[model samples]
Structures are given as C-alpha cells and as structure tokens.
Target: MSGNSVPGQGAAPRRSPEALPPRSKLAITASRVTAAISRRAGKGSGSVIGGKLALRLAPDLLAQLSVGLQVVLISGTNGKTTTTRLVAEAMRAAGPVVSNALGANMPAGITSALAGAGDEARYGVIEVDEKYLAGVARDSDPVAIALLNLSRDQLDRAAETRMLAEKWREGLRGRDAIVVANADDPLIVWAASSSKDVLWVAAGQTWQEDSWSCPQCGGVMQRPGDDWFCSQCDFRRPSPTWSLAGDQMVDPDGRIWPLHLQLPGRANRANAVTAAAIASLFGVPVEAALERMKHVTAVAGRYDVVDYMGRKLRLLLAKNPAGWVETFSLINPPPTPVILSVNALDADGKDTSWIWDVDFTQLAGRPLFVLGQRRLDLAVRLEVAGLQFQVFETAAQAVAACPPGQIEVIANYTAFQQLRKTIKEAAQA
Candidate 1:
C-alpha cells in the first residue's frame, strides 16, 4: 500500500466513490436507454429519440465526463456529416479515430455517439447540428472545429443564415483549436475570421439563391453575373488557401477529369472540396487524398447510388434549399424516369415551406413521380411552381409505379430512409 501523499513528489492514493461527488443514476439510465433506442432505430435516421427528448437528456449525461479528451466538432447548414466523415477517414490514416458513421448531428445524438465510441479512442470527430453548435462548444472544449458554409435550411427549426452565423461566431469565440471554413461563403468567411487559426477552402461557384443580401449592410450584394461578390461591403469571397483547381472542377463523367464521384450533382464539388481541405489539414497529402476521394462510394443517403435489378438508381437527400437547387441543376439532360419523395411531419419538422424555395421550375415539362405522406403538399408546390409530376400517396405505390427505365430518387431525411427500405425490401422479395 502507498503511504500518505507527499507535499510535491512522492505518491498519491486513489479515492473511493464516497470521496467523489455522486452522479444521478436516473440521468445515466436515461442516457443508456436513449442510446439503445438510437442504435436500434438505425443511424440512417435519427428520429428514434425525439429531437426535443434528446436535447433534454444530453446535458446531465455530459456532466459525468472526468476524462480530458480532444474532440473535433463540425457544423453547418449542409455538408456537416459528410465533411465530418471525410476528416475522420483522413485522420484515421494518421492515428486511431472514432466517429459516428451515421448522420447524427444533434446534441444528444452527439452525446449518444461519443458515449458509444468507447473510452479507448485516441481522437473523436463529431458532426454537430447547426442549432446545437453553441451547446456543444459550451459542453465540450473541442480540439478543432470546422465551420462549413451557411445556407438557408429549415426556417422553422433553425433561424436564418445571419442568425445561425451569429450563433456560430459566439460558439467559436474562445476556442484555441484550429477552425477551417469555406472562404467562398461570405457568412462563413466573416464568422471564421473571429478565430486565430483559420484555414479557408473554396469550391468556386455553381448557383445562388438567398445569398443575395449583404449581412453587413442593408444593400443588395453585387455579383459579377457569373461569380458572387459583395459590393455593398468589404465582405467578399476570400482567396482560399486551397481551391479545387484544374480538371478537378469539371463534371465527374467529363473526360477532362478522371475523378468520378458516385454522388451525382455539382454541389458534390463543395462536399469534395470540404473533404479534401479537411484531409490536407490532417496531414494527408493532397494527391493521395484526392485519389481516395475519387473512389468514395457514397455517404449513405446523400446522393448515394444503388444498383437494383440491373438498373442504376441514385438516392439524393435534398432537405434544404441549397441542396434542392444543386440537385435540380444536376438534373440536366434529365433522366428518363425520376422519383421524388417528400414528407412533412414531426419527424421531419413539419415544415413544407422549403418546397417553395426549391427551383422546381427547372423540372418544367419533364415528368417526375412525387410521393410520400405529404404528397399533396409537394404536388401543390410543384403545381404552383408550374412543374409537371405524378403524385402518389405512399412511397411503395410510387416506387412500384416507377417507369422501367433508369430512375433517380430524390428525397429528404425520413423520405430517404423510407425509399431505401422500400427498395431493399422489393429487391429481397
């Protein structure tokens, strides 16, 4: 047995549980139960533990941490989970890494992910939800933080881009960790500047929608028609430390570039750029990282492609405006048969307002199969937008009605899950 602890050097004794403050068993039990539910429901969709329920249960569970661990927290209106996975994969090349393979970006979901990774991991990479960014910063002193682009998403659950930017700025205030941001986004550039160690990456531009007004001034931001620049204020797209250059900017199938992303849509360039920038920061060589990115199969429902019955179908998760615009723009030359799944309820925030923001007019004259619980809502929006489509009340009926040609299924969070499961079940039968 060790003797009494010395003043400065000799030895110290471990304390028993009575010597330490007691924890609430009720809180621990709740966290455990929540975690089990999350696992069973599958990480594909985080609707198992209600969002409000998860938020309420996370704080107490976070209070039990005695270990000083380094965490990498990433949050944005879009691309958070994909970028988180990319960084985790790259970091894994350097050392042991643990991350939530599923797109669980909320606070309690994050707590659930961290708790499940076990205590042995040397590093942790987590994708935080936009609304919960501040809460995460307050709870965990992350080793690094990545602030991706701010885009208009669910205005019901989340605030406007400016409001979310202000929240992120506040969350990133006192961190000593390195913060990587998209230099191209005016909002991200402004917020990322608040940090000392900032790395900026750009993916150029493709399309624009709500990024019209200047955050600093009340004037309309100026764009050179092709590229976006703010003439109202000094806030402009910064010169990025890393930019997707050369043939890398070309389309995936174009002969100019050898890179082929399984994920469709040009918006994936932004995701790829974010992934590449993250990989470079973690010591993965640019060339080698690009090589690995070239072979990326898919990140689940985010433009994930699947093969069924000798037919190729792509599953695109277009939950927000930016996503919708990007995906719509990628539908050029159009596939023969296209399927869209939409849902509006508690699980998906019951916000059908986002449909108004999508450029469904691009699908004008082209036929699409729109299906889900909120098929009427989607049909109404499409009709208002003057886009033609067939509506189905259920996903199964819509999928069955799918034309025998190549199909592209575009869906949101829950809709994506329902579509995937339907396709899987149909294949098994």
Candidate 2:
C-alpha cells in the first residue's frame, strides 16, 4: 500500500456504520414468512417478495439491518451483478459481506439481502438499480458507491441515459459516500461530476453511442486521445486515478498491476479493476483482492456453461445494446452456431426498439439461430441487415438447428433466466 499510494490521496476515510437504526424484528419476521411462502410456491430466489414484505413491515429495513456494517453499493446499467460479486469477494478481508446474490437489484431485493445477512457480517455489498440509487443510497448509507456506466436500457421503464445521469448527480451531491465512477463514460462522468470525494476509474465504456453527446453542454464530444472532451463546454472525462492499461491496472501513483480474472472479456476485467480500486479504498491488499476475484467462475448465470439438454452451451445474458456489444466481443464469431434469444417481457423491457441500436450487421452472412418471444422481430432486423439467420419457435429447436460445435447461447432478461432455470433444474435432476 505504501509503494502504490493506494491508501493516500484517492483513499477515503473508513466509515464503519454507527448511529444507524437497530435491526427490525417485525421486518425480519415478515421477510422470513414471505421467503418461506415464495420458496414453497416454487418461486425462484424469493428475494423480492421477502424484501417487499420486509420493507412493508419496516420501511427503514435497510437502514436498520445496515447498522454497524460498512456498505458498498454498486449501481449501473450493466455488470452490476457481476461487479457486486467481485466486490463482495474482495471485501471479504474487510469482514463478512452480505450481497444480493439473486441479482435482484431494487429496494426490495436489497432489503431481502439485509434480512438474510449473517449477524457477524461487517460489510454489505449491495447491487442497486440505477433508478432507485438515491433512496437506496440514503437507506444503506454506503461508505463507497460504484457508479458504472449508465446506458439506454429498459426504455419502457428506465429514464434516458442523460436524465438518469442528472438524477445521479443531484442525488449524490454532498452525500457522505465516496463515489467510484467510470470516467470513460460521459454519462457516468457527468453523474458524479457534482459529487464530493469521487475517485475515477477509467473502466472501458463499450457503448459510445449512448454517451457521444456531452451531458452538460449537449454538444458532440470529441475523443482525441484516451480521454473525451466536450467541444462547447468544460465537461470532459476526468483524469482517472485508476485506469486499465490492457490487462494491467495503473493505480493512482502510476504503478501498474496485472489484472487476472477467471471471468471472460474486457468487461469483466474492467469490472475487476473497479472492485479492486474500491477494495484498496477499504485497505484491502490489491494482490489479495485480485486473487479472491480469480476464483469466481460465474455470476448469477451470466457466463455459466451448463448442459443444455445434454449439449454444452455457454449461457450469456445481453439485456441491452451495450450489454449485447460487450457480450458479442467476448465470444468468437461465425460458424459457431449461437442461440440468439430475445424477449419483450416486463423485466426484459416492454419496448423492443432498442434492438435497432445494435450493430447486428456485423453478423451479416454468418449463421445465427434466433428464438424467443421477439425472435420474429429479430428475424426482420437480421433480414434487413442481410444476415443469414434461421428462426425457431423454441430454444430446443434453435439449438438443434445450430451446426454441430460448441454452442453459445445469448438471451435477454426473461429468456436468459428461463434458460438458466431449465438447465439448472436439469443438472440437479
């Protein structure tokens, strides 16, 4: 820590939870009952139902459960689940950590995590929904907040990226939390611009389209070098205290450390760097934090390779254009038959127009087996893009239609969960 300067300027004062409300007995009882009922009814996770009940019984459930614990809240459009997992792993040396393992990120889900937290836990790493960050941040009283890139996702229910950025900026102003933000994303940069005690991490931003315009001046941004700047205003990417130099991470003092992650892709590596940066703020050894993250194989089924009806299929989730772009870059292209699944459910975003934002033309003349509720919509997009694709009414049919090779399955929210459930249950049986 002395050599790296990690515990100096960029580091924030350690804030152990104090003066918080005590654990709510009523909330705990309600949560337990709700969880039991949900589990008995075969509902997955039972986190949300339990959390809703817990919060209903005790509106300040998170504030109560978070007493005497250091909370690190992670919020973003993508990678929240995976980042939270990595953060939790790194935060272990600080103390026992309670995290949202079910990938339920709303207030209800966070309440559920708090309800189930071990009494011995000293830290709570909660994945927060971007829209609910302000309120949740206040409730959890996070010592450190990770603001990953905000993107155009769940358009039916989610605010535009720019609006969301402003909301974050407003919510975080003068807050006691030390914010760790992605400087590469204009939206993320703008969101934390007004925040105090912000430590910037140059975590790569894959979705440039969403942040091409300056959030402050509304002018087109120019990316001259490694940094981006607004042409008409002072808004620009902050000089990152921590940044990725290929697989290596450069800390505040300009010392480089290699990032080794078991999870695939630049995105996961970027996520690891952010978590490591946060851990360093909490006095966790950088090497020790990275070592712990290497053991994490999958996160809430995002990159889990499961037996899909006896055939090996690597499960990948892509909820929006940004997520899809990163997911596409992670895997090999062509000939490898992929099950392209999409759904327009409430969880998947009722509006499917965001599909047009993706550069599906890259897959032109390549083989793609499309399925799910929005498969037909995808077919049209594929057809217009002059891509070679086969549409199947079911995932099983699509899997069968693929060429005989290692299969990669990409699905949206509900479709991905449905596939994960089926494969997991089959494996258990």
Candidate 3:
C-alpha cells in the first residue's frame, strides 16, 4: 500500500452537529423536503431539482456537506455509474459510504446525495460528469480520484476527447489526491500523468478508435503486445501496478485474484478491477473487496432482467458508439431477438449522427426491433448497414411482438429510463 493510504479501522473524526451555518442547514432541510415531495408526487427522485434549489439558497452547501469526510470522485465517458456502485460497495468493507447510485452525475444531483447522508457516513463515492470534474474536485477535496477511459460522447454538447483530456490534465496538475487511472488508454494516461501520486491500472480498453493518436505530440501511436507508445515523442503507456487478465486481477506482486462478479461482459470485469484498486487505497484487502463486489448484479437499471408482456427482457444502456460496441458483446446470440431504442432529447444528445459510428452490421442475422423518438434515424442507419429491422411505437409493442423468450433491449439515456418506467408500470398494473 502507498504511504498516503488511509486506515480503514477506527471511528472517523466526527464533525460538530452544528458545523453548518443556519442558512446551509436550512438549504439541506429544504432539499430533503422537496426530494420527498417529488418522490411522493411520482415526478422522479428529484435529486436534480432539490439540489438545484439547495445550491440556489446556499451556494457553498456542497463544500459544507463535504467537511470531515473522505471523498472519492469518479469521472469518465463510460462506466462511471457502474464503477461508482462497485467502489461504494467495496468501501463498505472499510466504513459506511454515501453514493449517487441513481446515475445522477452533475453538481445538483451530487449535492442532493450528500445532503441526505447521515453522520455515520464516513466516505463519499461520487460519480461526476467529465466536464464538471475539476470544480467538483476543488469543492470536495477528494482523497482519491478515479479516471476511467474517455471516448466520444454527446458531441453536440461535449468537447472533443483531446480537449477534455487537456482539461483533466490542467485540473489534476498539482492536486494531492491519489489518481487511479487506466494505462491502456493514452488519453487517460496523459490526463493523470501530471498528478504527484498515481496508481495506474491496465484495465482493458475495447474501443480504440478515439485514441489512435498521442494527445501530447500529435503523432501516430504504436501498440506492441499490450503496450502503447508515441512514434513522434517521448510519450508512452505507464507501467501499471495492477492489471486485469481475463476474469482475474493481477496485483503488484503478481498474485492472481479471480473476480467472480455477477455483472456481465469484459467491461464489467474491468470495472471490478478498477473498483478493487480504489478500495485498496483505503486499506481494504483486494480479496475482500472483490468478494463484496460480487453482490452487485445490477447498477441502476443496467443489466436488469424484468418480465414484461410475457417476455424476459434484459435492459442494457448504451449512450454512445463505444458504449454500443460494448453492449453488443453482452447480448444473446444471433437467432435471439434484440430491440434498439434511441432518443434525441437533451439528455440523449440532440444530434443523432453518432449512430453512424457504431457498426450495426453485427446484428445482421438477428431479429431487430427499433423504437423511441429517433427510431427512424436508427432504422436508416441499420438499413445502410444492410440489416432489416422493424419499427415499433412503444417498448410494450416491441416486446409483445417478439417471440416469447429471452430478449435484449439496448437504449440510450432517456430511452432506457422510459423503458424501465414502462415495465414497472405494467408490472404494477
């Protein structure tokens, strides 16, 4: 373990019950009240709205809520929510933890999550949006920061991959937090290279389209047997202390620990490895951490199997091209049916052009059903890929029309939430 690692045992130093100013206390009270009302009204969790109102009333409530707690901020384009859940579960082996388990990654949502935490909560596991990472880090003063893989997502609203990488680099330059970063990705490596203390993990990266060039020298990158280097400059992949080999995790001493996770796909195995690495920083044993992570079968609604319309539907969320590529690997084989849902709402990126980047030809032999506001856009892309698909108006319609058996449903942000709600409502009825 690093010298900077925190001890897991013993009581965390308690903060005064009256530490917050009167106004900040009032803000937290208002936030919790509004969230409860929202849930009762069937609006939603209301984390965003409640936190927005709290911040409006008390702008520094986030910092006030973070005092005396060890915070870990996780940011990435893909797998942030899953990784956050895994880490939070593992950290419980050390002490009580609070997390945004509902997939809200922005400031308002984060505030609501923290405002409701009890005094026994000693650690904060926050999943932050990639763009808001620097500010969150500044306010929370985290003890550790996990920088997962970065890829192209929401191009209509987000900056380019290289630009975001630069922002991360500048944001993390002189920070004292321990940075756990992925060494397989050149962009992630560059972003965390400036940190004083870094724990690099060779977590596999399946999608390499966005990281073909070195972010520093603008040169072609060479990958030689699990290693990457820049041909034009002195930049290369760092030597990682931890790595993932198949379903097993390799520690610094080369000891192998098999991860028997309930989550599906290689992406989740990589997430487990990352979560184990983060838990180790707080003095949790790697074996115990992996054991705790095995209990997380589903995160939010991802990988949830629910019966709707007499068909077993497994829900998978894929918001971008890289995510879609990973999602395709976890579905049933060709003959089984699959449904693809997409939306162009602000939550799901208004521009639908990124769908062209995904290789939809792989679903050629399967029965494909398309739906959502952007069904036509997805149908056109599938048509261009020489695949046949049927368009449906609703998730129930698509599931009812499929052959009565196991089915896979892959959707973007808003579409996935809508499907989960639809299934829940039907089951209640």
lDDT (CA) per prediction = 0.65, 0.83, 0.91
Ten contiguous residues with the weakest lDDT in model 1: 1-10
**What TM-score does each of the candidates earn?**
0.82, 0.93, 0.97
- Name model 2 segments beyond 4 Å from true: 1-23
Compare the candidates by TM-score and give the number of the best one. 3
Candidate 1 Cα outliers beyond 4 Å, as residue runs: 1-34, 37-68, 205-207, 225-229, 246-260, 307-312, 427-429
When sorted by lDDT, best at the front, the candidate numbers are: 3, 2, 1
**By the lDDT metric, which is better: model 2 or model 3?**
3
Candidate 3 per-residue lDDT, tens place, 134-238, comes to 999999888899999999999899999999999999999899899999999999999999888899999988899999998998999999989999999999999
How does model 3 score by TM-score?
Answer: 0.97
RMSD score of candidate 1 (Å): 7.5
Q: Per-residue lDDT for 39-70 in model 2, tens only?
A: 99888768898888878777876777776667
Ranking by TM-score: 3, 2, 1
Model 1: lDDT equals: 0.65
Best by lDDT: 3
